[model samples]
Target: MPLVFSDQDLQTHNTLGLPARAAVATLDDESAIPDLCEALSSGRETDAPLFVLGGGSNLVVAARPRRRVLRVALRGIRLWRETTTHWFVEAAAGEPWHGFVDHCLSQGWPGLENLALIPGTVGAAPVQNIGAYGLELDQRLHSVVAWDLRAGRERELRADECGFAYRDSLFKRDGAGRWLIVRVRFALPKAWAPRLDYPDLRDYPGLGSPTGGAGEIPSPRSIFDAVCDIRRRKLPDPAVQGNAGSFFKNPVIDAGQADRLRHRYPDLKAYPQADGRVKLAAGWLIEQAGWKGRRLGPVGMHERQALVLVNHGGAQSADVLALARAVRADVQARFGVDLEQEPVVLD
Candidate 1:
């Protein structure tokens, strides 16, 4: 069985630095999953609700949670297999996401360069279908190995079996306590090309011309460095000021609604999707609503990037949710668009 602790303090576990406590169990070895599952199934343990935790980068924990927290600390990485067109890499669930990306690049695997510097663990990546700079994890994922709590067995799911959408997946939608990801496999393409389609990346100085002209194409490391720099400049360091990255996901609206908003507010920043919908920038909306840098108690949206909600000092779950509600209400009343919070809330 894995090591279990009673009423573990979660302040350091989450990036937001919120104070929380719960019955915590650490699953450091894959071999212990069966025993862990059996323990839960027997109901001899506490009947409290169970929650799976990763890096805690994208989470909001309520103070004094009446739940059992399962911290997935399983760790390993390997070049799983290779094909003519792709290099398959497998990483344990507990590995830091950015470190995994950097490791792959160091080994000459370049497909995940665009997603560099993202917070969280490999196991949590597919849950949110994490994306950045014109690339989403689903695009590169090959398969996932997870322990199905319902079946009481380990299972490997193909990419297709995992319903992936914009910032959502099967694990996120239905897995919850039903599935515990053990490992993630990525199929990085060998024939790599830089994904500079995102405006910030394309317009970054010293990264060659926007037209892909005579200038030398940037390497995977160069793109990775640029992305890291951009994020650092825009988003606050969670260590310095507590935050959960972007507080809201970019809202997708119908084409008609987007057109109306754009017509009324000429400066609206909206991107057309392949589908008939349009994705409006949540930061711009929050800033326009006059909530940028505004605070309710100790929590507020970061001035540098309006999308990031920061915990200036001692902030509780109530404070975070109150600010989120206020922001969402203001944005909705102003533009008739609903802003959805990105991070998962654990009560």
Candidate 2:
């Protein structure tokens, strides 16, 4: 049987630190999954909606959720296989993402270096298709093992079937409650090359240019360290200031619209996409709209990085939403680009 708790305090669960509560079931082992499924099907548990939780880094608790929360605590890591060009590694869903990344690098696997300091669990990575420093999880993903609630069995989903997009996946689009991830597999390259294409990584002190210039090329460990240092300098620690990193997705717009915006603002930061669309920097827009370091109630955008929304202290979910709405409205009015909130809201 899984350990269960009632009226669980959720202030510590989410990085945003919003006050909320819910009945929670902790699943720490895979063997208990069948029992959980049976309980859910037999209605032995309350008939409330179910919410699967990981590290709680990418969430906002809007209210006391009248739901049963399944907190995935499953954990393990192993070298699944090795090919001529790749090292296949597998990790349980509940493993800490950064720790897993670091483990891979420490074991001499190099592909996950660029993703080093991201918060959340392994299972959550595929859902958001998390990316940073020019590397996305989809590029290293091999497959995902999950339990299908509707079908009442386990299924292995290949990388192609995941439908990965910019910060999105099939697990996010169609597997809300239907698919509960159990484990994730990654195919890290053996012939590794440092990804220094992103501006920050390229300009990192002492790390030679991508074409090999001023200094020695960074190893996987150095790249991992650099990423960690960069993130620590830019984003606030959740333990000190409650925040969900990168509050909004960079808005993608057609080339014509981007051109018009660039004509008006000249300094607008836009990246051209393969599909002829342009991705605008949400942080740049938010800062330009004058929301940076500004506070509404007890919530505000981080002064250092405008993209992060932080709770000053004693904040509620309402305050967070109010600030988000105001920020979104202002950016839309000014740039005509809609800012979509990235964190999942629970109520």
Candidate 3:
């Protein structure tokens, strides 16, 4: 574990382009976890809370303390194949998520193409069950390897044990700070089955191309490419405008409630959730409430995406927060639906 202390904001993450004055630590050696835990857990002398960050893509860190906040930079990939159908691949948590997806597609594996262009690391993917375009990570996941800081030991957990849900898992539910991910593994098939029902990517003509070899699918590449295109057009480039793609997880409501809202609005759109509940697009509701592209001080909704709140340069965290609160209140008042932000807000 080679740790570095810096007073400067490391980088403007996808989060509203705010820089966190945080220290960045990297764990390159898998065997060094025990020692790393002992050092990070020695919180006896400081009031600063310890945090584990990866890719800095999912956070909004406005202030950083002097203590260690480790960012997993572990990078590697390995495959274990007992048979063509019984194989899984493992990767270090810090590996660029899309890079891994592309690698798998090159090898003809399936299950992650729909999740392409998602910003962040593989380790963080399972925590929130990162999903898009009609796909969730759990559909192909096998297990996860994380270091339990309190126990001073490493544990490999089955996918079910990780507690998968819509935009949530055990880690996200409990505000997980103690578990440090080291590596992740997934079980996928070479065959192709297109999940193109989502509107953004359904038009891809060759979406269900069959695999030539075991677990090798022709459709994954097409799907991945198409998703990237959709994301580029819909999501503002973080490098330019700086924002998380979608700020809120769509609110799930009962069909009756959904029908009532739709009947009232006459144009409000919703989709069926996996459970019996139906989901209302928060963006659509926000736009209908006339919050889209509305500005207050330096923060406002992006003109292109009703869900994304942008820091229009030199905006403070307080400004952005106020806008979010206003948007939430407006949406709730108009549609009786609540909005939840996707970024992790640091105090």
- The TM-scores, one per candidate, come to 0.97, 0.96, 0.90
Candidate 1 residue-wise lDDT, 315-342, digit = tens: 9999999999999999999999999998
Candidate 2 global lDDT: 0.89
Q: Give the alpha carbon lDDT tens digit for every residue of 1-347 in model 3.
A: 43444454655533567755665555677776766667656854254555777776666656554445666778998785536564588888999898999998787666788999998889889887899888889888899888777777889899899989888887777664678888898988655577777877666554445543433344667788888887888878777886766778888889899989878878778887778789888889888889788889887887888988777787766777788889899988888888888777665
TM-score between model 2 and native: 0.96
Q: Per-residue alpha-carbon lDDT of model 2 for 1-347, expressed as tens digits?
A: 66565778888889888888888878898888887777777778556767889999989886678667888999999999999999999999999999999999879888998998899999999999999999989999999999987667899999999899988898888845677999999999888888999999888887643444666667788788889999999999998999989999999999999999999999999999999999999999999999999999899999999999999999998899899999999999999999999888777
CA deviation > 4 Å runs, candidate 1: 208-214
Clashes of 3: 3
What ordering of candidates by lDDT runs from best to worst?
1, 2, 3
Cα displacement (Å) at residue 81, model 1:
0.5
Instruction: Give the CA lDDT, 0 to 100, for residue 247 in model 3.
Output: 75
Q: What is residue 20's positional error in candidate 2, in angstroms?
A: 1.6
Candidate 2 lDDT for residue 292: 94
